[model samples]
Target: MIKIGVLIPEQYKLLSVAAILEVFEAANKFQFASELKETFDITLLTINNQVDSFFKTYKTDTINTEEKFELILIPSFTTNDIKNTIALNRAYIPWLIKQYNSAAEIATFCTGAFLLGATGLLDGKAATTHVDACAAFSAAFPSVQLKADKTVTQDGRLFTSGGATSTFHLLLYLLQIHCGKDLAIKTAKIFAIDMDRHNQSYFSSFQPLRHHNDEIVACAQEKIELNYQDISTIEEMIKDIPSSRRNIVRRFKQVIGITPIEYLQQTRIEAAKKLLEQTAQQMTEVIYNSGYNDPKAFRKIFRKTVGMTPSQYRDKFQAR
Candidate 1:
């Protein structure tokens, strides 16, 4: 039997863990009423026997440091407090590293990449997380090649998926490699999964952090956000601020993980995305209303950022 251990850490997302259990259990029962019996031996390993009460009904065991598995799955955390969540579950880092060294394949769902990243196994490896958390993940693990646009990414035995529903894609990928394409397709069909999906950038909404105490950077951000429709550049926008342009740029990048100009572009792109999803206005109107003066540059930037043409994005995300 293929043994798989799903780690049940504190603050884990219930849906992530539940979906994983459901998939493997369903895999075991795929040939129900036959002499084939079950195939996968699924186990839940909890952190200090402290998993969420929601999983109490499931048979679980405390993490056995000496136990080994063919594969381990890390579930996404519930909160956006990724840093603290990583620290809270720091005990799993060494276990994960040891498991990886012992030939166990590791898979992470959405924000679970943050935990795996803390172990340094993801260093220099291609990985993806929740599209909205890509910036924070990149800042935390600069060595990891963050594929923010991908629905799923794999490097060596390490696998990661972007956002919520993308978890099933990774599960299907794992099944495709280990079991067979047919089983993968079977699971996908059971879940009604659209196997064609590969990009998550269009689902991303740029939300920059504003909790930093850098007043100069704050002022710069304020000017860019409030005056995004204005024809003023970053340099012109920051003229009224007390600090020089160089200092402001440095602090802005330090605090926000992006340059002021890039932040403005992200803001404008968010505005453009809302327009695309909410309005039937002409393309030129979207361009101008979102603070772009040129249609060519806007389309190019939109495609580069959102991973689709404006029309395609609208067609996919626009309300019926």
Candidate 2:
């Protein structure tokens, strides 16, 4: 049985927590159908051994790294929580280290990367956090190699992400690895999320030096140019890029100043913008050809990133 543990702090992003749980639940359902049995044992863990009756924070009753855990997930916490817990806390840190030492895979969503950074386990390891927290993450733990364009990254046993919504990406990544690609696809559909809406693999090689590192960035850039109409997995990208996954993530973030996923999001948005500006294509067709299945989600991401709705962007561009 795969024992999955989630370390929760107060006021954690409910969506991320719920997403992880749902993915596992889906996996459990699949396993049950396949073998007529549950293949997982999931536990919600906390720091102290006290259950807060009001908020329903259950106490962590035990720690036995001897029992193998397939995955350990940590959701994002506040900045204050990151600082206070990273440097000073041994209460859960040691156990976390123990889990790392064990065969269990570890992953974080959003700012939860801070806790992994706290363990000093990420020294020179590829990881990511919510883009808004990038500066703070780099400043706080310079030893950690932070990637910019990724929604999630997997460096050996460690995994991480850059935002609240990226939690879905992280879970899907794990599902592909542990459960199967088909299940990941199904889960994405079940949730009405665009499977191709975001590309976590792009951040594998993003960099801060926009113009200087043309050699490496161009490789990824060319692939995007050639396959902008088609999307591939991270494994497929690695096969084409000739860089190890970790090295790609580390170097890409250094050159592009954004994670690969961010770049892809930007690229797709830019493409959508251009289509919106120059073509008479309907909104649904624009979104579909651009690789987004959800028009509402497309509008939301576009408006959030571009500062206007698709209609607004088209109107302004048309007027110009």
Candidate 3:
């Protein structure tokens, strides 16, 4: 049997934990039907030797601080404040490192990558998280290559999935790797999950961070958001922001992880996307209204950022 340890960290999402258990339990039933024995020895490991009353049906054990498992699962947390969540779950770091050194594979779902990255184990490895959290993750772990567009990323034994439904894709991938493609296909059919999905870009909403204390950066961001449609250039929009263009650019990048120009482009793209989804406006009108005079440039950037053409995006996501 493959030993699988699912870490139940502080603030762990109940849905994430439930999904992990359900998938593995389904796989184990398949094994029992065929091989007359379960293929997995699954255990929920927690630092505090405690579990909520909701999970009384499943196996729960306090982490021994010393053990080896073939695979370890890190489920996403419920909170957006990742720094505090990681600190709350700090005791898992050394245990994770010890298990990895003992040759255990680690898989994280959505923002769970933030907790995994906290261990420094994800340093210099390709990983991803929730699309909404990708910017924050990049700033927090510069050494780790962030693939925001990918629904799932695998670097050696470290596996990560994007957000929400994207977690099913990674579970399917894990199933295919361990149990075989036949089982994976059957499981996907059972769950109504489209196993062919691979990119998360179209699911993302460009949420510009606004709570930072940098007044100058905030001013530049405000100018970019307010003038994205009317202005031809970011410099023109922020010319009256009371700082040198170079200084504004520096602080903007420092605070926002993207340059002022990039931020403007993102703001414009978001506007275009909203129009595509919610309005019946013509493509040309959408482009110009989104601050792009050139349809070709708009289409190019839209495809590059969204992983699909404007028409395709609208066809898929437009409101009925």
Measured on C-alpha atoms, candidate 1 has an lDDT of 0.89
- Span of ten consecutive residues with least summed lDDT in model 3: 58-67
lDDT of 3 by residue, 157-274 (tens): 9999999988899998999999899989888887899999999999999998899999999988887888899876666967788888788888888988999888888999999999
Report lDDT (CA) for all predictions.
Answer: 0.89, 0.71, 0.90
Name the runs in model 2 displaced over 4 angstroms.
51-60, 64-66, 78-81, 85-90, 197-320
Q: After superposition, how far is residue 66 of candidate 3 from its true place, in Å?
A: 3.2
Q: How close is candidate 1 to the true structure, as a TM-score?
A: 0.96
- Put down candidate 1 lDDT per residue, 79-194, tens digits, no spaces: 88888999889988988999899999999999999999999999999999999999999999999999999999999999999999999999989888987887788888999999
For each candidate in turn, the TM-score is 0.96, 0.59, 0.98
Name the better of 1 and 2 by lDDT. Answer: 1
Where does candidate 1 have its weakest 10-residue lDDT segment?
Answer: 28-37
Q: How many residue pairs clash in each candidate?
A: 0, 25, 0
Candidate 3: C-alpha RMSD after superposition? 1.1
Top model number, TM-score: 3
